[model samples]
Target: MYKLQVVKELHSSEGKMILDVDISVQQGSFTSIVGKSGAGKTTILRMLAGLVKPDKGSIHSGEDIWFDSNTRKNKVPQERSIGFVFQDFALFPNMSVLENLKCVQSEKDEEQIKELLSLTGLTALSGFRPDALSGGQKQRLALARALVRKPKLLILDEPFSAIDQETRIRLQQEILKIHKAYNLTTILVSHDLTEVLRLSDYVIEIGNGKIVRQGNTDLFFSNEGKTDQFRMTGQVVDLICENEKCFAYVVVGTMLIKARVEDSMNTALGIGDLVVLSLNDFNPIIKKIKP
Candidate 1:
């Protein structure tokens, strides 16, 4: 199991901020960090990658120790054996797809690049440059480069944020495939609740630099963490039915939401009814906001 116990502070013009966090992940489990912007999600991941030094805390992966602020022991980023895929798809503009993979590895381990290419279905596009590939293909190359060394831990930060809807779905499936194949201890940083629900075995909900909730995804669906966030005062414009359940369209200002209408909904809603259609505790997370 991988465990993280950390307390860090950030100094800014706004004021001093403390990020007190504690979490654990079982081996081969997919864990997600979910929170609003500036909630310290990226900071935690950067700390694990050894890119950012924490004010105080320790990080342990099973029996191995990665960082101990008390002892002043910190591993170099390259020595940590961590695979990171940032949201920007940071592929090298100067290198071909295959060459990018080769740069991260030694000449003695050149054959591993071929394995990565095939795994991500990029073997045929090995000769292509970053600019020549599609968004999904470029994302795959970025991931392939990360896995070329077969790192023990994989961390992705808002990976789906840049891709189109169709590409995002395809990439999500590919990610699940790779994670299971390697049995990697994966950590995902994302704000999309649906992605967290679908991809993660455990979720850590951060609010104002602290963990507000932590548990299995199923438990979250049964009892939502914040019910008030689901309700929006709007007008019911349309009723959509699938599998005999109704999904009502609620229009608030310029925004529209497809809310699941429960049997107990008091207002009799029809087209253009000025009534609030409360959103369900959970809404399907798509890469893009759909109408």
Candidate 2:
């Protein structure tokens, strides 16, 4: 289990504010932290990763105390068992993909490096540098490098914000696969609400440098009055047309939802199309059709 209670002062575009947060996450659980810009979402991740110091409280995982203000005990970033993927790929421009992963270790292990390359589907491009790879591939390499240490906790801050929608979805699936295969506790900071809802088992909503709410994914998405509308992304499984009205069957994660399409919108939809499904007043509306 992971326990965190930390406070820090931050200065941003919103001015100075105290980031006071308290939350607990079970081991091997996938949690996403969501908030507007400068709401301290990234700061929370940095504190957990030992990249930033908190003014007060403590952070503990299992029997390991990562940080405690009372005793002035704090582990440096290298001392903490954490894998962090930053918003940018952060790969070494001068090093090849294989070299990047090898650099993480004091002593290189060829077998381990090869395994990570295969796991992240970068085996073919191991000889290439970050500049030669696509946006998706660079992010994948970053993930591989982070996992070289076999960290117990994985922290990602807006890792997919730069990628295209198709690549973003693919990377999200890759992240889930990595999380389960390694059974690592994962925390993601993302502004993409649909991506968060789709991949996270739990969600933490922060506002004004404080934790406004934290709960299961269902509770976070199902909560009413939080917004005027909610958006979800899914693949079209079936499409039916009757007279001027059309109905679309979309597979959103494990749940299948039907969305009604107006005649004017019917010309833009088809089976197997990836689309955004919005909900308002319990009614499904399709928007932002993806090619």
Candidate 3:
């Protein structure tokens, strides 16, 4: 088991907040941390990575002690055998895609490098620099680089936030595949609740620099009232008409969700209209507005 007990004080724009958390994670579990901005989600990941030290606490993985406040034993990032994927694809600007993966390796293993490049779909663009790759490609490179060391724990800090919806979904599927193939203990911090629900086996909710809740994904679904009646509100920005289908471009928060409109309600919706959108299983249902 991976055990963490932390008590730390953080100063933010709002004020000083205490982050006190006690959490235990089973090996090879995919866990996600969800919360509003500045809620210490990333901080937890950083602490686990050995980049940040708690004021008073200890982190242990089975028999290995990663951090212990009383003993003053805090292992460095390199010693922790952790793979971190940052929000900003922090690849070396001077290095090529292949070089980025090779740089982190403790030994020169050409076969391993080639395998990772193929796994991440970067074999075609292996010689390209970071600036030349698309957002999705760069993210794939980052994942490849992180996995180059074959880490026991994988940490991701909103790694998909910058990508488009389609690319984000694809990468999410890729991450799931990699996690299982590698049998890695993965921890992710994301603000996208839907993505958290889809990807995480265990979910941890953080607020005000503290852990608000932590449990299996079902517990989170129950707490969020996500029954069969899951609905969200958005504004109709534009309408796309094709063949026999009408798709409404709706702006929900920062996400522009494409929802299909029923024929009965097609003429009822217009630009700048507030609408309710629901997802029954995978099909989208756009509620008719009472205008």
Best candidate according to TM-score: 2
Q: By summed lDDT, which 10 consecutive residues of candidate 2 come out lowest?
A: 220-229
* Cα lDDT of model 3 by residue, 69-171, tens digit: 9999999999998999999989999999988988899888999999888889999999999999999999999999999998999999999999987788789
Error of 1 at 211 (Å): 0.6
Question: What would the per-residue lDDT of candidate 1 be over residues 1-291, giving only the tens digit for each residue?
Answer: 777789888764667779889888888899999887878899999999999988888988778888998889898889788999999998899999988998887444757777788888899999889999988898999899888878989999998897886677668779989999987989999865555655788888887789988888656544553424544455554567899787765544324455666666524555444554343446721111224
lDDT of 3: 0.86
Residue 9 miss distance in model 3 (angstroms): 1.2
Q: Any idea what lDDT model 2 has? A: 0.86
Residues 65-142 of candidate 2 have per-residue lDDT tens digits of 999999999999898889999999889999999889988864668888888899999999989999999999999999
In candidate 2, which residue pairs get closer than 3 Å at backbone N, Cα or C atoms, i.e. clash? none
Query: How many pairs collide in each candidate, listed in order?
Result: 0, 0, 0
Comparing 1 with 3 on lDDT, the higher-scoring candidate is: 3
Q: List the residue pairs that clash in candidate 1.
A: none
lDDT at 113, model 2? 85
Each candidate structure's TM-score, on Cα atoms with residue i matched to residue i, is 0.77, 0.83, 0.81
